[model samples]
Target chain A: MLDAVRTARPRVQVITNPVAQGYTANMLLAIGARPSMTSSPEEIAAFIAVSGSLLVNLGILDRHRRDASLTAVEVAREMGVPWVLDPVKVDISPPRLDFARTLIGMEPDFVRANHDEFVGLGGADTGEEAVRHFAARNLTTVALSGPVDIVTDGTRIVRIANGHPLMDRVTAMGCAGTAVAAAFRAVEPDPLIAAAAALTVMGIAGEVAAAASSGPGSFAGAILDALYGLDAATILEKARLT
Target chain B: MLDAVRTARPRVQVITNPVAQGYTANMLLAIGARPSMTSSPEEIAAFIAVSGSLLVNLGILDRHRRDASLTAVEVAREMGVPWVLDPVKVDISPPRLDFARTLIGMEPDFVRANHDEFVGLGGADTGEEAVRHFAARNLTTVALSGPVDIVTDGTRIVRIANGHPLMDRVTAMGCAGTAVAAAFRAVEPDPLIAAAAALTVMGIAGEVAAAASSGPGSFAGAILDALYGLDAATILEKARLT
Candidate 1:
């Protein structure tokens, strides 16, 4: 996946919460991809027209922000650019859940959710059932993050069990993971392969962070260090992507 | 300054644009400052209550975001946490200029502005005069950015004549500079010294970026590399603080 990103250097457009814009864009750049964030509806279509992939995150959702996200998704679809959706904290409210459902109809190439969010969206009794539900919806890829990450492409499912438990303590680890997924998706055409690669990398980094840090504060710093320091050879050796 | 930040590891609360949030926070972390972004009026005060310093940015101002910025400044003032203000595009309109004036009245520890913005806010004929105007208004420190940056504490002024011309082409160099200033302010209690250190560092990095790149797109990448690669010794050696 890193090889593909290095070779393609795909341009990724992210319309996410303003909080993560700078870090997410720099993260994409660090991994050898171009990134731009445009939220104005006037600019979204033009940006989507040029981007290789799009990532929509509903982290700082407001009426104005939601309008922009919807417009960006519509434009990405029209341009045939594969898009990923991060339905951050959708289970928090009925309005948010309904909004997520509306986005689901946009047919994102990948949908990423944490354990609770996966269960909320899929009504699944277990992670495996959640994956199955996502597959049944004809979603290209479903990434369910927890103790073990499940990446499925309807017919085939891969489980990555590399990340540490400490990752659950950080504030935006899931959002960062979504950004990583978008980075991989920017380069790889297959959403399943991209999702698998991202989950593996994040999980491995999480483990490395846990080894270095004692708590959430230091863990956030360590996670970034591990992600920035990770190499393809190291990933192949340490990743549990099956 | 790096020694101070490395030792203190201050938590700096920032109320700024969503576009630059991630980059600003990452840069702060790279330099050993903990950064959090909260734009909600309630959340801003809540975070600032525990933070070491406050950084308020009026970069992408709108009706809703302006309230958060105002609330943050008020909280910072009440808490006596040294704060820096970036009056982005204050020169563009009367309303923005008035808004900046109102905040300036709150007596920020430091004021960081680009040449045009400084002139616009102060109604000065030149950047130097703008710095003087800000200093006269009881501003503890004022940094006016141009080809050469002038950082002052009323009586003593340092001229940093480093940096690349290509930096002028980028969109958020000033905002990034403000973020770096906030990082420095988080470490050093003396607003003048902190502003000088940040301005000098950003200037030198800009020069390095110009040497390594052909245009704005490539220069942005090189600038990040320069910022990440720079060390305290190299900064002090090449930095023209006076």
Candidate 2:
């Protein structure tokens, strides 16, 4: 996935939260993806037309952003562009949670979220049960991320154990994670492999970053550097799959 | 100003562009200012009511964010809270430029912008001319940030020569700079001194961060770390004011 992303240099359109916009764009740029965060309803369709993948993040939802996300997803589906959904902070807001569930009906290629958000999407505890529930309904890859990230389909489950606790301290790490899934999905055909590869890249980078960081402040920069410096050999050697 | 911010722990409300949110919030947090980016019109007034300072940035001028910024600034005025206006990217959008010009009549306590934005706000060339133009019209301090940031009122001019060129490569540095001014203004009543102090903090931190960085990626982390570790002695000894 890392080699594919570096070679293709996918152009990704991201409809994300205000809190995640800067860092997410920076993260994509560091990882060799061209990112555009155009949220205007009038302009979103046009931008998604040229994008290699789409990332829809339902965090800090508003009328305009919601409209743009809906439009972009529809266009991405029509164009056969892979998209990833991140239901960020959905548990805290009922309307946002409902909105995310509605988008789930669209059957995005990948749905990545934390344990709380995955549960909030009307799924049960334990990543296996939740991902199995979704995979049974539709051909989608479900990733329930936490201390040890979980990636699965109905038949196969992959658990990644390469992240650090310090990742939880930084803001927007989850948002950036879903974006990595979108970038990987753009080049990798299998949704399950794409989701797991994205997690592997993020987790390995987190471990490397945590080693060099004093706190979350330095961790943010270190993570980007690690991603930029990542290679296929390192990813193949460091990946912890179960 | 740094001492005041650390002691008071001011709660700053920011109505800024999507691209500036994460880093701006991080900058305020590292500087001991509690930051909030509530943009809903329904909640902007309530948030501003409790905020120590308000920062309205016209970076990505959307209707909702603009309305929230306008509402927050008005409420800030009524509540006697100092506010800073950052007319970012005014050169690109005429409607947003006009909107920023209209808000200028509201008599913001401080106006911070780059050379192009200052010129877009109907000010003349060079930081001195543009800032003096605004200062002459109203009792507002104008900050024109560049290689050597210039902060001034109608009667007095303070030049800050402590920054590095690498700061220009990082996105949202100017927005974060304006946010730092807002944080300082929350504690220091005098706008000129407050703006100068804020610029001093950012500039000196930039110099320190640049020395420790290999490129923009590490520089981003180093800047935050430097800001976190900054002291009065460092600022006094490293500040290059003319």
Candidate 3:
């Protein structure tokens, strides 16, 4: 799937939170994917329809993103393109949380979220069973990310433990991960494998980035270099997936 | 101004485009200044009124940002606080260009723009003379940035040439520079000195960051570290101001 992503160089429409537009676009580019980052209502529906996949990251929810997300998802659904949702900070705002639940109900192909976000999304906090239950109920693939990332689609479950704490220090790291997932999902048919493949690559990239970085500032740049430099062997060897 | 910023750690309200939200905040934090990035009209007037300075960066023009900028500027002016404007990509859209001219007429304390943006704002492209004329006519400080950065305020014109090419490769680099300028303007009484000091520090930091970075990605992180580590002597020794 990862190799396919590189070879195909699929275009992914990312309606990312304004904060992560640049990082998400650069992250996609580093992983050999083309990123179209236009959240404008006038352009989103058409842009998302033609994209290989769509990623909606609700990092900082506003009217613009809320309206754009609805339109983009409708078009993606009509066009049958895979999409990923990263519902960020859903625990804080009721309006934002409501919007996130609305997106999840639409059944994006994959969801990349952290513990708090998953919990806020009505997922149980009992680890594997909770992830599987949430995926089963939603009929969607889920990547429960943190120090160790848990990816599942109800039936099949996998855990990838490979990233560094420095990864968390960088801004919009999770949003960038969703962009990577959207890129991988463009080529991979199975949602389960696509989410895992993307997270695995990101985990390995994070570890590689941390090794060469002295602080969060340096990690921001090194991660892109690490993502660009990754080969099958490095991922295969370093990805602690089970 | 730089020393005062570090000592006081003034809060700056940045109505920046989504692309530079994280970078601008990080850049401010690195320089020992607090950054408040909220483009919500529900809160912008209050935020800007209390902030040490306000920086409005029109990197990606949208309704939310437009509304917030207008409100923030009004509040800042009423409070007698200094404000800077970064009219990004003003030449591309007529509507956007019209809005930029509107903002320029309000007389922001400082204007940080590229050569193209300055020209689009009706400034002649003949370098120093044009920059001075624009600043004098508008009764504002102007930082005309390019391979060489020209900071002028009608009467005084200074050129700073110390930045690296890699700085342009990073996303929102110019917006981050605007954030830096805002932080300096918060502490300095003179707008010309504030803009010049900020650009000189940014240019020197870019060179410092480029030395430690291998690519644009690493340069992003390295630049923050470089900004955080900058000292008066290092800036004085490395700055190329003529």
Local accuracy by lDDT, each model: 0.76, 0.84, 0.85
lDDT of 1 by residue, B44-75 (tens): 56568778888888877887778878888788
> By lDDT, highest first, what's the ranking?
3, 2, 1
Evaluated on CA atoms against the true complex, candidate 3 attains a DockQ of 0.19
Q: fnat, candidate 2?
A: 0.21
Give candidate 1 misplaced runs (Cα > 4 Å). A1-15, A19-58, A61-176, A179-197, A201-242, B6-9, B22-26, B127-130
State the weakest 10-residue window (summed lDDT) of model 3 chain B.
Answer: B88-97
Which has the better lDDT: candidate 1, or candidate 2? 2
Q: For residues A5-103, write the lDDT of model 3, one tens digit per residue.
A: 778989898887766888987788777787767666655655666689999888878787789889989889988988889989997778888998899
What is the per-residue lDDT of model 1 for residues A24-107, given as tens digits with 9 covering 90 to 100? 776676667788887887778888888888898876566767898888888888888889999875654446667888998889
Task: Report the lDDT of model 2 for residue B229.
Answer: 77
- Is candidate 1 or 2 superior in DockQ? 2
Model 3 ranges with Cα > 4 A deviation: A1-13, A17-54, A58-64, A72-174, A181-203, A210-222, A228-242, B37-51, B60-62, B91-95, B115-139, B154-156, B169-171, B213-221
Candidate maximizing DockQ: 3
Error of 3 at B144 (Å): 3.1
